[model samples]
Target: MKKTVILGTLLLGLALGGNAQTKTPVGSIGKNDPKAKAILDGVSTKLKSLKSLVANFVLKVEGGNSKVTDSQKGTVYVKGQKYKVLMGDREIISDNKTSWTYSKDVNEVQINNVDQSGQSMTPAKLFTNFYDKDYLYRLIGETTEKGKVLQNIELTPVDKSKNIFKAQVDVDKKAQTIVRMKIFEKNGNKMSYEISSIQPNATVADAMFTFDAKKYPGVEVVDLR
Candidate 1:
């Protein structure tokens, strides 16, 4: 269950992830849909203005036969480079320097130092110019869901070696926010995140990003930092 929760979080980032620190020239990237770029840029602009965010979402995992194997509700808090994700029986917290993965079922917490050297996407980067160079995206037309019209965009990774082959993002046209994200892996596993609610510019404290052992009395600490 620990591994499943961690992998779910990683895939969640990929479903709404991007690395903006490194610059990839526009011209160097392959041809993309202009309409999709416009919508995505608008989302990035709106999200960049937020100082902090709290979001609730539902994660649905499907197997090779397209059967819903698992479903979980999760919440994410993001402020700058700090983030905390809670899904089912586990919670992952990071303060940009240190990270703690706590498993409530087993009463264990694994600590590790944040790897600044890697290109892995952080939760905060999901709102930046994440789709600019990493993927070739195109508008997949609009659909009406729950009375709101949503624009769908399909994204294919620029690098072919990635485990994720493609992803689809559904953006609420009027709200200019992501409504849903579906990721397709090479192994035929599908994971989708449906945004339930979002609180932009929420009042968040710095202390929320770090884990306090006191909160979980009997948790065994496995510090690998």
Candidate 2:
């Protein structure tokens, strides 16, 4: 489903320390301009303070007759080498090495390595290094970021042919926080997730990031191994 891509990619952006809603203008970077490098350098720094975050997402969809929509509230915990996402009946857990997605409805969990490379907008590894040689970046106009006027940053998939979702990330120059994000699918469906509230360096439970099948009785695992 296109909506799933939007959702998955949105989560991917979280791992990248980038936003998909605000598009930063790239008119300034070209050929061999140093301004381009400067902009990315700033993005690298802004992305470092990010440790843990929790957000609520609202998903809406409408078509001819079948209308599907839902809102998911979840918390994302990231500490040193661990990450966990708890959303309704879906849970994604990773220990900076292995990753797994568990769905309560189906009682199945899919597992994968945390490499996150070339799997779409999921650049979890890139979080530690905000630069992906293939993605392009530039500063757009400033609107409102983290309650202050900051520089807007835009990122585009360099290898468009394999791009997962076109993104626009709004970054607060002063607060160094990503305020809003918009993700557009290659199929023309647009999904936007805004950071209504952001809490940084929040204490995250260590156990939540691990998958303990014993914790959920009868829950099965689907090894995408």
Candidate 3:
């Protein structure tokens, strides 16, 4: 008798899920829609004003139904093609020509020139020229999260393999920012990033993107070219 009840409950749940999925309107399902367009415009407007931004954030992640938290304090410098991410006593610098990742723990730095693809959190790429880039966009349906309104958009690279997520990205519309990002890999591993306490236009220096070899005495430089 108990087994029968459980099976009935499961069947009912599936029925409800199917109904909800079919109920969503198709007009808001991709980019160029009124709501999604406004969202992209708002995000662009917010990014254009930011010359350089520094923010201290804590990442809250849920892996395997368990909650894990990590704190990252960093600064981003956006001066044309030059960009840098300084965090946790380490720094990644792209000096408009060559890029290097400096690590104090391993006592070495990695250097590469003209490797400006598939990396995240790039101020110049993510900010100034976001919408202008060649991305296939869709509305991604309604904007709601946990019963609240959130900007939702789906983006796929023109080249299928370039984008890890392939399916879509959920954006928070009212905040004009990315609430969380998800990347689905073929091997059943999904990487997620939730943004918090992002302060834009914070006072940052251009020197932050410069790599001074003399400044660091002993370090290993790994060039991944």
Top candidate (TM-score): 1
Sort every candidate by lDDT, greatest first.
1, 2, 3
> Which ten contiguous residues of candidate 3 have the minimum total lDDT?
8-17
Candidate 2 lDDT over 1-225, as tens digits, reads 432244443332221233334553356433322444565566556555567544444444323243334445555555655666666787777776688788889988888776655443332333444435656666555554234664555566666784334555655556555555555556664445554455557767777677988878887777775
Q: Lowest-scoring 10 consecutive residues by lDDT in candidate 1?
A: 13-22
What digit string (tens of lDDT, one per residue) describes model 1 on residues 1-225?
A: 234333333323213333122222333246898888999999889988889999888888889898889888888898987898888898888898998899999999999888776445667667677678678988866777667777778888888987888888878889998887888888998887887778889999999999999988988999997
Q: Candidate 1 — which residues are off by over 4 angstroms? A: 1-29
Report lDDT per candidate. 0.77, 0.54, 0.50
**What value of lDDT does candidate 1 attain over all alpha carbons?**
0.77
> Once superposed on the true structure, which residue ranges of model 2 sit more than 4 Å away at CA?
1-40, 46-70, 116-126, 144-147, 163-165
C-alpha TM-score for every candidate: 0.84, 0.72, 0.67
Native-structure RMSD, model 2: 5.5
* CA lDDT for candidate 2: 0.54
Q: How would you encode candidate 3's per-residue C-alpha lDDT over 168-217 as one tens digit per residue?
A: 44555566665544443344433444444565666667777777888888
TM-score sort, best first: 1, 2, 3
